[model samples]
Target: MRIPESFFVIYQPKYTVPCVFDLNERGTFPNHPSVTGTWGFRVLADTDLKASVQFAHLVHRPGKDPQTGKAYEWMVEETSIDLDDQLTLDSAAVEKKITDSEIRSALMDAFNEWHDNFVPMKKKKVDIEELKQKLGNVVDECKERIRKELVRKNQHWVSSNIPRRIHDFKYGLYNHVKERLYQEYQSNGGEDSEPNLLKKIALFNRVLDNFDHEDLMKPDGTVWRNEDEIWQCWIGFAGSEDEAYRICRTMDAVFKDLELDEVG
Candidate 1:
């Protein structure tokens, strides 16, 4: 058979293992001298960095083991076979077919030799339960630190920019009023103060009737002068853990609804 071009697993255990072989783009297995020069076949395994024996490439086959009466898959050493025509031969013409038992024994022998040499130095498998508890503690600590830092940063930003924002807002409001006053002054013959004033009042009243004041109202029922004020108010309101959780839940629900729509 022609050797596969992709990385193939020779053996795999029930748990995670480090991959040993790193394949370069030139199609050479640098880790194994036996298969270093051979091209076409690529093998990769996950093994401990300290140990030479790494196991990776999980292959799931159907059916239970006849001997153990439990479903199991073959885990063996990965080897690259040469793609040269000299290595390719018809088994029928050769008059000897390797049985499954023989193949298993050969692979097991190779695995055992490699394991014996390097397994003594390999670190013990990590206790997942203990690690999970430690992870939870770390996450809680991280959340608290992040919350505090965000609050400090936001307060600093608001303090530094509040004066500038207030000044800009005042200037904008003054300009709007000034433009209306100028328009009324010109339309009312420039010299008639009473007519200009009356016209300005009527124009402002019409503006109040047509404009949506609620557009400037924040969620907390306070009016905002500018977009920065609105953003600052929103950040302050939603900075709590509960608000974050609610937002996440809402986003998750929206995504799920979109997925269901796609499926339908």
Candidate 2:
């Protein structure tokens, strides 16, 4: 009868500990002199548990060497629980996987929705009226205050230092209008008041005028004027914060005139 071979079980407290052995007959047992390489088993540990009973075994194999026909291998034994048990995964690890998968699925769905539904819808609808309304809204909110102020101050004929001065002017005018709105809001019992309505109406009128002016300036539009020095000056003066404030003040005065006209 053949006697059963006694297997030596090596116990490593840390799973990161590498198992080194030479498959070649010429290499030593513990330290392989013929082949110099390292192999380790990865251990996924439950961060909450300090004991050895909370580690999951994962096998790691490095790239094979062409010269030595020997391949490295190591066994990872389940320390916390049986490998067959799905409950071996801690709550944290399961939660992380679930969260990661959810994020990935959401991103994919968003991409597909944009590609399939949104892009196609964009090409189908070509509403010029809606587009005009949107453009009008932007121009009214952004360009109206600057235009009114420039016109009121009679600064339309001055030269502009930079071509982008109109952009700066628009920003300045927006801030001025916003501050006035805030002040009106505060004075009229906060957001719920007649003064807020008046403020909105005034702002709307200003925006409308701006839209009209822009349309007039366009070549194909009704009120086309040659690019003049006054227009340049208006843009330049409006670009400066101090000049922009002056222009807004002039616009406020013009609104006061309108209020008087309505009363008259």
The candidate that achieves the highest lDDT relative to the unseen native structure? 1
**Lowest-lDDT window of 10 residues in candidate 1?**
46-55
Write the residue-wise lDDT of candidate 1 on 1-264 in tens digits.
122221223333322222323332222221332322211212122111111122222223344545556644432234332211111223332123223454435444554453343222315744445534543444444445544554454444334444554455346533434444434444433443443333333322222221355576533344444443333233333454444333334334444555676699
The candidate that achieves the highest TM-score relative to the unseen native structure? 1
Off by over 4 Å in 1: 1-126, 159-240, 247-264
Instruction: Give the per-residue lDDT digits (tens) of candidate 2, residues 1-264.
Output: 010111111122232323332133222222222323232111121212111112222234333435565554432222232111111224344343334455335433433343233122234654445534543443343344544554454423222222234444346544445545445444433433434334333332332333445443422233423333234324333443344344455456545655676699
Distance from true position, residue 140, model 2, in Å?
24
Overlapping backbone residue pairs in candidate 1 total: 10
